[model samples]
Target: MFTVIEEQEQRLLEIRRALHRHPELAYQEKQTSALIGKELDRLGISYAAGLAGGTGIRAELGKGTGPCVALRADMDALPVLEETGLDFASQQSGVMHACGHDGHTAMLLGAAELLARSTVLDEIGGRAALLFQPAEEAGNGAEAMIADNCLQDVEMIFCGHIDTHHPVGHLAVDQGLICSYADPFLIEICGRGGHAARPHEAVDAVVVGASLVLNIQTMVSRMINPARPGVITVGRIAAGAVHNVIAGRAVLEGTIRSTHPDTREQIIRRMQGVVRGLEEMCRAEISFTLHRGLPAVVNDPVSCALARQAAREVVGADQVISQGFPSLGGEDFSFYQQKIPGTMIRFGAAKDPSAGPAHSGSFDFDEKVLACGSRWLATVAVYGLRYLQKS
Candidate 1:
């Protein structure tokens, strides 16, 4: 398997660079989706296009019957300008594959290239499903794909993310709570507007909003258990337009990330109490809107075992790591795991140890990870199917 991937290493590099040159945003991957389709066509891998808001593609390899395992890759870019000086850096201004989605997409395509030529699927009476999902950054792509029945008849699913923090060839395949549940919230405060000079006459929305932000920050420390990993971050705040006049309205946008459901609910309830108390004390109307986001990615132990087996085989036993701590970061891949047994491998792609993390303007990874990731995906798919058949 490694030899096959090595033979196509140059081809994979070209494909990843081609994708890196033209990054597309969530649900708007027209050219990216087209390119994937083109590659699938070349590999003679039949797939259905125009799904999941017209960007998700599902391709199948092997016989139509028997057990099936699926592998997924996200296709989307961040709204950040590129700063990497690489010749193949993103050509699209204010849009870059800063999070290694470009690498993820290319690796999945590389896996497709390998699986298309292999006979394991046929021998095991199984199939491999490849999903090129869009809008993972927007956090709804997985749901859209599921709505389109992308998980239909799929027994086990696997996906991977490029982790720049770890060296190339390492894979993190730990089971249970690998990622956090993300919940976004918006707080709007409405207060009486009056002359700035007459401080006694108006309720200052800015002051109330600022106080609310401070109070919300304390929820994690005061209300939620200190032992559990939880974060409440107010990322953006908007208030008065002018300096002289008292603002009538203010908006605060933030997110809540937690590992357990009890802790998440505890924070939400405490936030409501805090908002109510602040509103009563300041005589302002406060509205809190929390949008339920992706669930924590808790890998199934059985599925993770398959990933671990594949990772060990592809990159040796030492390169396969069992992560000790869960990430506060969220992933839409959790949506798929909610429906069926699934796990996500964090593939190490860091080319430089000091390089910036994902979503940074200069983020890039070692192209060598492409072959390793592809081999792991292909290997895991076959192993998952065999495991299912035996059970």
Candidate 2:
């Protein structure tokens, strides 16, 4: 079973390195999409090109009339300069695959090739769809693909991400709530401007902004239940221009994350109340804008069990971790789960202590996990299709 992917491990490594060397950002994945299309063509797999009205690719493989299972890989890179010092570091300036999307794409392609050659489709009852998505870092790629009807007729879907927190060859399978809700917000406070020396003339926008920042922090500590996990982080703040003049306006940008739906709603309501209170107390006109990002990724129990069984077969039961902690980070893969039963597994790729976390400039992982991931994805697709058919 593993020999299929083992034979192509070196090729997968080379492809991942090539993608790492020429990372592309968000919707600008022209070269990346072209490479994927060319690979699909080489495998004789027909796929829809330019999906999501952009650079998303979708390929289906099978001959039987069975339930359709889908496998997804995000193909966007971040705007971080490479500092890994590896020979195949990013060639594109200010762009890098710090989140392991390069490896994700390569592994999915490897699975596609393996399934293309195997008789799993004949044995099972349905086909498998390979979804190469773009712009996950920008946070709308999954929604775009769903809008394009990518999940049509798809009964079950599976995706995986490389995690440096776990050792190589390990798999983390969460049965429910694998990720948190991520909502970004911006607050602009406008006030009267005056001389810095004046003590009582200006409305003091800077003072109001600073106070609002502290007050909003209480949303997590004071407003919500401490037992439930929630966070409100102010990532950026910009205000005054010069040292002598009092600024008339200030801006605050941050993100809110929560695991539960009721908790998330409570946080939003409290945030709005805080903003209103600040406006009334500081005597400044304030506007708050919240752009809801990805929702929490909740795994379907049956699908998660199928994936875990596949992982146990590929890497042994000892290596399959079923009790790993969930992450606060967001994944757009949640979008597909909203429509169909879906699960996203975490592949252990941390080779050494030197490997940094995801989205970091020095992020890199063990290449051995590529083959393991490829085999796991292919096996899970087969099992998932059969399971969905039975259900």
Candidate 3:
């Protein structure tokens, strides 16, 4: 049944590899966007490019006009050097698709081509939107797309991340939240400078910052509900210019994620409280700012049911999994759900067990899922379009 899909996706995979070779960062995916546009055009589908406040591209198909089912893929790479020794490994230094966004883009582009050529899809009252977005790594891309009305007519959205954590060709679908709200924060503490020998002369912003970092952990361990999941970690700290002298300024940066918004608010409030407490204790002034990243990735229940049916059609029911809960990971795709019903499926990227997981820079995905992901996305759009028609 998927033989034609396999043949068509092989070409799509060639396109994916070409992208992998020349990885681009957030907001700078001109070539990548252009490639997607060209492919959609070749498939006889019309598209819009330079969208969503960045290098966003989109394509539309079918005339039934039921509901617009948007299939989205990110068009950005991470700032990591590629160590994978594939023939098409990233030539761009310090930027690679270590997170499998390259595969995501290819899969969705493949789906666009498949749907463009599918009579069954069009017969189901299909109206599809293909979104090629940028700045997902930087966290502002989705907001840019939303601001541009990317979700105006979208009835439902479907997206997937390559999961090296799961076995090859295994698809994971879940109802409700599948990922957490990741927000990065920066804190600046100001204090009096002094010589190292004179501990009392300086307000010791470093000490205050250290105290705040330690106390911040309590928000998750002590304050937040034990049953609910939450995480707080300080990733970086820059203070004191010299080892022998106490610097007047210090910085603390980290991220906080949780399943619930109230819990997130509590964590933020508690973190601020800790900083405020340290300020009073150390007599150091502090300023803090939390830049929004992504809201929790919540999979709509109705959309999830349809996804299960689609996955079963593509890879049998045994391949579909619905047992796990959401992770603390963040996804910009959540932005789509904010405007329309959506499900973020996890396509297994670890084809070989010997290979390590994603984000390792050396991590490589089981490209076999290229076929699986492509068909699954196409099927979901068909299901969503059909569901919209019935409603």
Candidate 4:
């Protein structure tokens, strides 16, 4: 086997197309996991299947010597209809790789191949752990994996997502706070149901829900610090079914997010207090449900420097730039960064220059970046392992 995996650039693209053709949704990546496991076995890398999270695969290259540097790639697809019209488009109807996870999986797999074939990696270096995780789009995958001891031997971890907004072959990230904390919340209001015409007879839950929304807006704007950043979006609202009847219950579903955990908690508490007050004033019952998706993802300073150095080697120095703005999007990789001094970077994967954006039905990324993504990840794993050993 040749170091650098001579035909890896081609392998990345081909694997991406294959995964695209057979996309699967979160927690149901049996075919995807099996395919990756087979490839890892073929490379002769020692691996463990069904560990850390739903259908996750872990493979280690080189002898168990120095601290391991982990590279992560999420394997779950999204619940969107494929309309890209590419030849290798998703075969699974109503489930597609709309989030570019297919690209991530392919890139990490390429890195694995490169590391496996590298004589330097096997003889003179430490181990590089390639993590193929499932269900990252849902945001619980990282934590579930950690709970199962995925990061036990990992001293540092790095993960990346394909961003449509950034240019191809470009990478962006802040030294800290790369992504936001995503917390889902729900509001339920119950009141008396009666004839629509009799205004005094019924406490309409629909009216109360409407008032609650307005109050929530006020709370976010007035109670939250103006300088601090946060988002309060109501994604769904349901109430009355018939036109003439007063509904007894109304439900509101939304999410809260922030760059800081304290800020996230403060905003959530204030939102609940506001909803409680509204229910009390309207004489209605209220309920809440929360599914904490991910905590904020922060990049370690030392890791950031290492990434920039690694990227600059693959691309020019001018191509590597520090990102000032932090994204409000959530990532399960946050769980890894929590314990390990990890850094999550962004890679350009947009397909069409005229493309609208990612996560849409027409989501796509340029296939050329596959080569760059693989090379960068492989180089980083190699360099990072060496860097750790030096320390």
Candidate 5:
């Protein structure tokens, strides 16, 4: 399988570059979806396009005699302008594949090619579902796909991401709690508007909002468990229109990250307490709202072991390592895991120590890891199917 993937390495790179050139954002991945459909057609694999709001494609391979396993790849790009001066930089304005989704899509397509040519499915008497998903960056792609019955018969699933934190040829696989539960929050501080010079007439909303921001920071530090990782970052604040007048409204926007459910609840409750206290003290009406995002990606132990085995086969035994700490970053893959067992593997794509980080316009990865990623995806799907059949 690795040999076949290596033989098509150049083709995979070309696909990746083409995706990088014509990047799309969220549900607007028309060209990307069309490209994937065309490739699946060329491979003679059966698939359903126009899924998940017309941008997701579900392709199938192998005989449907046993448990089904899924292999997923996100196909959306970030809303970032290209800064990397590569010849194949994004042609789409203000849109770029800065998070290596292009590479992920290419590798999965390569894996599709491999699985289509091999007899592994016939041997295991199972099927592999290739989920070409969109809108992962917007954090609801998996949910949309699930609603469309993408995991209708999937017993287990496997996916991978490109990471510049590690060198090429390495794979990071950890058993549980690999990602954080991310939630975005907004707070509106409403006060009475009056003359700025009148010391006692106006209830200054900016001052109240600033106080709430500072207090919100303590929800993670002073309220949450010290051992459990948690963080609250206030990224945006909109308040006041004029300099001389006391503004009546202030809006604060931020995000929350927690690893455990109990911790997440505790933080929210504590935030409510803080908001109530600030409202009472400032004599202002404060509204706090939290928009729930993705849950922490907790990998099943059985699935993790299978992924590690596949990584060892694709890379080397020594190159397969545990992801040391859980990431505060969130992934929509957790939505799929809520229904079935799934594991997310991270492939090292760093060319050097100075490799740019993900979600940045300057981000670029070493293309050599494309073959390794495809091999691991294909191997894990086969291994997972065999395990599911026996269990």
Candidate 6:
């Protein structure tokens, strides 16, 4: 199976580099979608473009009679500027493939090419649906694809993400809680403006906002159960315009993350209670808004076992690590799991310790993992489909 990917490794690298050079953001993946369509066309793979009511793509390869398995790759880039200094760095200003969606898209395309070859689909005994998803970073792509029936007739699904924290040959395949639920929030505090030197003349929104931030932090440490892990962070705050004037209004924006749904709900409820208390204590009005993001990525046991088996076959059993800590970061892949049994694996792509972390300006990895990822994705899709059909 790897030999197929190895044979097309150079072409895969070229495709990846080309995608890196022209990074697009969120739903604005026009060029990226076009490139994917062009590759699928060249490979003789039949596909439908403009899925999810936007620049998403879906392709299938195999006899249409058997169970179908879906493989997904996000096709969006971050807003970070390029600093990798690679010859194939981003050509667009203030946009870069800093989170490795470029590699994900390239590998999925390679998998489609390999799976669509003659006799491959027949041997697998089922069909493979390739999902080229957009706007994962902005967090609505999976929902949109689901709305577009991306998971129609799919029995099981598989996806993978490139992880720089792991070594180049390792694969992380935990059976539960791979990622956290992300909920973004905004808090607005309205108060009276006055001179900064006046101690008791007016209501100070800066003070109220500062208090609210600290109290919200305690929602995790004190309010929530110690056994349940949760996080609340205030990433941005805006208030007074002048140095000597007390702020009339202050806005706070941040994210909340949790591994459990109940914990997520608990934290939000506690946060609202805290805000209410602070508003009364400070004699001010406050408004809170929660933009519910993606859910925690919990792997289905059967699909996870299939993914592990595929990873061992593609790489080696020794290179497959089944136990790892769940990350606080959120993945929109979780949304797919809500509709069908699916698992998302982590492919090791870390090649340089000096390179910056994911979402950073100087992030990069060895291109060798591209072939590994492609093989793994293709193999897992086949294995998952066969398993689901038998079950």
- Total colliding residue pairs, candidate 5: 0
Best by lDDT: 5
Model 5 stretches astray by more than 4 angstroms: 4-7
How does residue 46 of candidate 6 score in lDDT?
A: 88
TM-score of 4: 0.94
C-alpha RMSD of candidate 1: 1.3
RMSD of each predicted structure: 1.3, 1.5, 1.8, 2.2, 1.6, 1.5
All candidates' lDDT scores? 0.90, 0.89, 0.84, 0.82, 0.91, 0.89
Candidate 6 colliding pairs: none
Cα lDDT tens digits, model 1, 201-318, are: 9999999998998888776777788788899999899988888999989999989999999989988889989999999999999999999998999999999999999999999999
Query: 1-391 in candidate 2: lDDT tens per residue?
Result: 6455445888899889989998999998989999999889999999998997589998999977888999999999999988999999999989999999999999999999889888878788699999999999888899999999888778899999998888889999889998999999999999988899994788888998898888888668888886678898888889989998888899999899998989899999988998899899888999999998889999988999999999999899999985355678989999898988899999988867786788889899998888989999999999898887788
When summed lDDT is taken over every stretch of 10 residues in candidate 2, the lowest stretch is 1-10
lDDT of 4 by residue, 1-391 (tens): 2233447667777889999999988888888999898888888888888874559888888885777999999999988888888888888888889888999999888888777767767655588888888889888888777877777688989877888777787876558887889898888888988899995799899999888788878877877786667887888999998999999989999888788777788888887787788778988898877777688888888888888777888777877765557888888898888788988888866556555466766778888777777878888887788788889
Best-fitting candidate, scored by TM-score? 1
TM-scores of the candidates in the order shown:
0.97, 0.96, 0.95, 0.94, 0.96, 0.96
What would the per-residue lDDT of candidate 3 be over residues 1-391, giving only the tens digit for each residue?
2334456767967988999998899898988888887887788888778897658986788887667898888889888888878899998888898888888899888787777777866577668888888988888798888888777788898888888877777899898988999999999999999999998888888888888877887667888996778998788999887799988899988888888998888888888888788778888899889987789999888999999889889888888876386788888888888888899889976656555566677878888888788888888888888888889
Assess candidate 5 and give its lDDT: 0.91
Show pairs that collide, candidate 5. none
Count of clashes in candidate 4: 6
lDDT of 4: 0.82
User: What lDDT score is found at residue 49 in candidate 4?
Assistant: 89
Q: Assess the local accuracy of residue 40 in candidate 6 as a C-alpha lDDT between 0 and 100.
A: 93
